[model samples]
Structures are given as structure tokens and as C-alpha cells.
Target: MPMRLFNIVYITILCLFSTFVIGQTLEILPPKNITTVQVFNPQKNDNTAIIRLGSNEYLLFLFDDLEAGYKRYNYKIEHRNADWSESNIFESEYVVGLNNDYVRTYKNSFNTYKKFTNYQIQFPNKDMNVKLGGNYLLKVYTTNEDQPIFTKRFAVYQGNVDVGMKSSRYINPTYKDINQRIQTVISSGSQNLTETPDGGKLFIMKNNNWNEHIADINPDFTRSNQLTYNNVEWTFEGGGEYNWFDTKNLDVPGLTTERNFRKDSVYHTVLRVDFPKYNLPYDDYGDVNGNFYIRNNRFGNEYLAASEADYSWVYFALDAFEDQNGLYEPYVVGAFNNWEISPQSKLKYNPVSKLWENEYFLKQGYYNYQYVVVNTKNKRVEPSYVSGSFWQTENLYQGLFYYRPWGGRYDILMGYGEVNTRN
Candidate 1:
């Protein structure tokens, strides 16, 4: 086999195996009874939870459970290495307090149909504090079971280094409409710090989606405590703005919703089939950066899923001229599924309607989604074709710097920063 083909095959195998292992171990979510899971830095409205070590910043974890009352939910923190696998350090070694803590903050939903309890927890609290700065996973489960029902990954960085990044037009003319380039510079704040080009790892992600992450990026050069990464490899497809629909109320259809009705006490919604006009001029309206906001219109300022949400079967349709053939398959990508492309988000082509159709049982809320084409041949996903790409499209970009010395046991999150296309 050709070297490039062999490498692609190897990476595909590794990704598949890694996904399988994570499905069995991490189990980021349970089968049912949970909804609207969000873990973010309270300081920002976006889904970024990466925070500075020992800072006042905290990660807020919230989820809704389908119950009128509370369940004995508890959480435990685990340390992770650069690969997101369990680190060699024990729980006691990283946590200053107890490893397990009960979720004491919860509220019952107010006036909505599907009763539920909203559970929330703020990390690095008085009872539990982080002692190590690196990757950490928050595992939540019932008190009776040892297995976790769900897990959230977050990072704590020491900020020992500085990160500066810029977004610009891609140099390649062939991809000018479809790609945007990012150039980054990292410099150590202290003179004693040293980062070898091979020992340092750079991770770049778009819109806070973990699955959309670019990992193991190497720098172009190193000078003392400074490193620069500038290459076409840093370019990402400038996916178009998200398509949104609000189902905040079952009685009324939201924008972009074609129709909504109730049958046999079950709610149904049909979204207007999207036919993106790529030739049209680029128009920039603000968006949630491909995130979903769970709320019911029945109660103002109350986003509690238990009393505020109504479950409904939302049918989505994409007007496509022909069946996606050869290497690429289409999927509905959004925060609903952690922006992960899977069978659940895959769309089926309907020949009679000439559209790609899919349905998801979603809670009543405002949702932002986009159509993404997945290249089956190389396991690469791109939204540029399905959704028009534009340089002006607002996007959140994150830069994570990981460093490990010659004899260090694990990679430390030395620095983290965010830049955007708008600013």
C-alpha cells in the first residue's frame, strides 16, 4: 500500500478502536432519562469549560433527569493523560478533598409536561478542589452503582505559557471559499521553561466540539521559550452558519418549522427542507456557534426541562439534488449529540422527495444544526459542501498547548486560549 493510504487506514483503525473503547469505558451518556447535558465555564455562554488552574473560574455541570423527585446522584473526578486515558495518579493525589461528592444543588421543573429534576454541580468547590493541572473527567452516577451514567471531560491549565492566534484567508485559491487558516504562537512566561518541538502537542478545535478537534499538531520552529506553528494543515473548512429552529412551545411552530401538530397526545414537528444557495453572497447573522438552547416558552426565564419541556419527534429534511454517492455520507451535526457524527445523526435519502430525511426525538427548545458530509474513505468530515463555507462566518477557535519534559510522566496543560473569526 502507498504510505499515505497506509497511514490513513491506520488512523481510521485507531479512531474506530478508540471510539469503541470510549463507548465501553467513558460512556459519556446513559441510554435514557437524561437530557440537556451541559458543562461550560460559567463565565462564558459558550460550551467551553477549559479554565485556568486555581483561578476563580469554575465549570458548571447541569443535566435533567426524568423524574418528579431527586435521585441520589454523585460525582467523582478522575485524572487523565494527554490521550484522555486514566492517568497513573490516584484520586487522592490530585483532589484536595473527598473524591465523591453528592449533588446538593437541584431544582424541580416548574410548569411543563414531562416532569424532571435539574441537577447541577460546580467544580473546584469548597469540598473538592483540583490539585493537579491537566485533563480531568467528571463522572456522575447514582450512589448505589459503581458505574457512571455519564461523564464530562474538562481541562485545567496552569497558564505557564502564552498563546496567541490569528485567523486569516486560506492561501490556497482552490479552497478559498471552503477553508480558513489559523496561525498560532506559544511563548513560555518563565525563562526556566523549555518545550521541545517533539515533546509539545498542539490541539485546535472549532466551536467547542471535541469530535471536531485537530490533534498532535507540530510547530514549525522553536526559539528559546517560543514556538510557532504555521502551515496549511492548520486550515479548517469554513462551514456556513447554522440552521436553527425554535420549538420552545408545542402549540406554536418556531421559525424554520414547517408544521407542528399533536396526534394521540404525541407532538410532531417538520422542519423546512434546507436548500442552501451557495452561489448567493455570504450573509453573516449571529448564531450560537452550533449549540442548542433548551427552554420552554411556557415559563419565562426558566429552562428546567422537567416542567418546561415537551418531548416531540422532530422531522428534518434537506433538499438534495441527488443521492450522496461514492465516499461521502450526510449527517445532521449539532450540539444535540455532542456534535459527533453517528448513525443517529445520519440522514437517509428519499428518492421520491429528493431530500435527505432524518428524525430525532428532541426536547422542546431552540436548536442550531448544520448538514455535514462525511468522507467514508478517509473518515474526514466537512460541512463546506452541504453548507456553504465563508470566511466571514463566525466561529469559535480554541488552542490547547500540552507540554512534557524529557522525563515527565504525563503531559501538562501548559496553556489554553480562544480566538474567534469575528474579532
Candidate 2:
């Protein structure tokens, strides 16, 4: 097998093994009715769920359950090593106080068609705080549940170094107009830090996607207190601005919303069919940058009860032609799925309808989504197949710096920085 293909298979096998091993500690099985899941730094709108260690910082996590009833939810944190495997450490070694706490704040949806309970909690709060700087996973579960309802991966980093990242047009002539390049530099003020050529690792992500991140990146060069990494592999297709539709008001549909009608038990809404954009020029517009927010306009107030909101079967349709490659499988990707490619988001091609379609049981809110084509052979996802790539498209890129001390068992996030293509 080719070296690249071989590496992919090897990594897949390793991941399966990790699943078998880590499954004992990390049990994440969210129900299908959960929606609008978000985890990020509350202070900064563009910040990821990464915070500085020992600082008065917190990571906010929120989600909505469409069950229409009250349920006790609690959370706990687990420390992980550089490779995301559960670290062999006791809870008291990293946690300062209580390791788990109940989610005291929840509200039922009110004055809306869908009824769901909104649940939110923040980490490093009164009951608990992290002591170690490494990778961490926050697991949310209900009372007496054997498995967690969901899990969000977050990081607590020690700001030991300064990171600088920038985005520009790709230098490769063929991909110049369609792709953008990323460059990173890490600098430390302390002279004690020495370069560990093979120990340093860098990860880059577009938007807030973790599954589609660019990993296994190493620094190209290292000086006394500086590291630089720039490569052609860091170039990413400038996916077109995300297509969005607002379902804030169940009674009225907007430009992107085709129509909405009530069904047997829930409402059904169909979004306008999206055609191939490869033939058209890029159009610049403001978007959530592929992120989504839960909004229920039917509720006159910002605070809402979980039960007052209603549910809808939102249908997303894409125009497809017979000439399209059969090997490519398209999946609807957005914050709704954590931007991860999964079977739940996979699209089905209907020859009779001449369209690719996927239906989601979503809450009444504003959402952003894009169709991405997954190459079955290599398991790589490309967004240009449905949403055309262009240089003008606005994109967000984030860089994370992981440092592991000598004899250290885990990686410490030393620096982080983000840049935009349009900046």
C-alpha cells in the first residue's frame, strides 16, 4: 500500500484500539434529541474552549434537550495525555475541590412551538478548578445514568510561550486562487526552554472543527526560543461562506427557508435547494463562520423555558446531477454535528428527485451548514465539491502549541492564536 494510505489505516486501527481502551473511562452517548451544543470561552466570541491555567477563566458549555421534561444533569472532568488518551492520574491530583457538580440552571421552552429544556454549565466554577495543564474532557450526564449524555473536549493551557499565526494566499500556483495557506511561529521569553525536535507537535483547525483538524505537524526550524512551521499541507481550501437559514419564528419563513408545515406530531420545514456553486464566483457575506446559535423568536424574552420551544424536521436538499462522481459521498456538516463527519449527517441521493437530501430533528433556531464530500477511499473530506472554494471566502484558523516537559507524561498547551483569511 502507498505510504500515505498505510499511515491512514494504521491511525484508524490505533483509534479503534483507543476506543476499546478509553471507552471504560469516557462514556459519551448523547441522545438524538439534543441540539445547539456549544463549548467555548465566554469572554471571547472567537476563542476556542481553551483557557489559561490558574487564571480566572472558564469554559462555557450549553445544550438543549428536546425531551420536554426536567432531568438532573451533572458533569465531571477527565485528564488526558497528548494523544487524547486518558491519563493515568487520580482525580485529586488535578482537581482542587469537588470533581463533579450538578447543573443547577435549566429552563423549559416557553411561548414556542417546540418544547425543550436548555441546560448550561461553566467549568472552573465554585465547586471545582483544574490544577494541571494538559488536555481535558468534560463529560455531561444525567442522574443514575450509566453513560454520559454527551462529552465536550476542552483544554487548560499554561501560557509559557507566545504564538503568532497568519493566513495568506497559497504559494502553489495551481491552488493559489482556491486555497489559503497558514504559517505559525512560537516564541518563548524564558531561556530555559530547549528545543525537542521530535517532541513538539502542532495542530491547526478551521472554524471550530476538531475532526477535520490538520494534525501531525512538526516545526520546520527551531532557534534559541523560536519555532517556525510552514508547509504546503497547511494550505486549506477556502470554503465558500456558509449557507444559513433562520427558524426563529415558526410562523414565518425567510429567504433560505422554503416552507414549513405541521406534521403528525412535529413540524416539517424544507430549506431551499442548494445548487452546485463551483461555476459561480465567490460572494462575500457575513455569516456565523459555520457556527450556530439557538434562537426562539416566538419567545419574547431572551431567557426561555426548555419546554416552551418546539421541534421540527428540517430537510436540507442539494441539487445533484448524474455526472457527479459516485465515489464521493456528501454529508451535511455544521456546528450541529460538532463539524464531525458521521453517519447521522450523511446525505442520501435520490435519483428520482434528482437531489441529495438529509433530514434533521432540530430545535427552532438559526443554523449554519455546508455540504462536504467525503472521499471513501482515503477518508478525506473536501468542501469544494458542493460549496465552491474561493480566495475571498472568510475563514478562521486556530493554532495550538503543546509542550511536554522532560519526563512529563502529558502535553501542556503553552500558546494559542487565531487568524482570519479576510484580515
Per-residue accuracy of model 2 over 302-360 as CA lDDT, tens digit each: 33523455678899998853234677778887877665566677788887887888998
Model 1, position 160: C-alpha lDDT score? 87
User: Which residue runs does candidate 1 get wrong by more than 4 Å?
Assistant: 1-24, 67-69, 143-146, 174-178, 191-197, 276-280, 298-307, 350-354
* Local lDDT at 254 for model 1: 77
Candidate 2 ranges beyond 4 A from true positions: 1-29, 143-146, 173-178, 195-197, 298-309, 321-325
lDDT of 1 at 221: 73
What C-alpha lDDT values do all the predictions have?
0.74, 0.72
Q: List, residue by residue over 1-423, the lDDT tens digit for candidate 1.
A: 122111122234225322324433653554467866887565765578788988889888888787659888899888877657667776777789888889999888765555678888888899998877788888898864467888877889988888888988765565555467788999885733454437787778888776565677767877778889896656776778888988988888877898999887678999988875466677787788888766777654433443457778899998753335657777787877666566777888887887889998787878899887666776665566667777778888888888777777777888998889878
Provide the TM-score for each candidate, comma-separated: 0.87, 0.87
**Best lDDT goes to which candidate?**
1
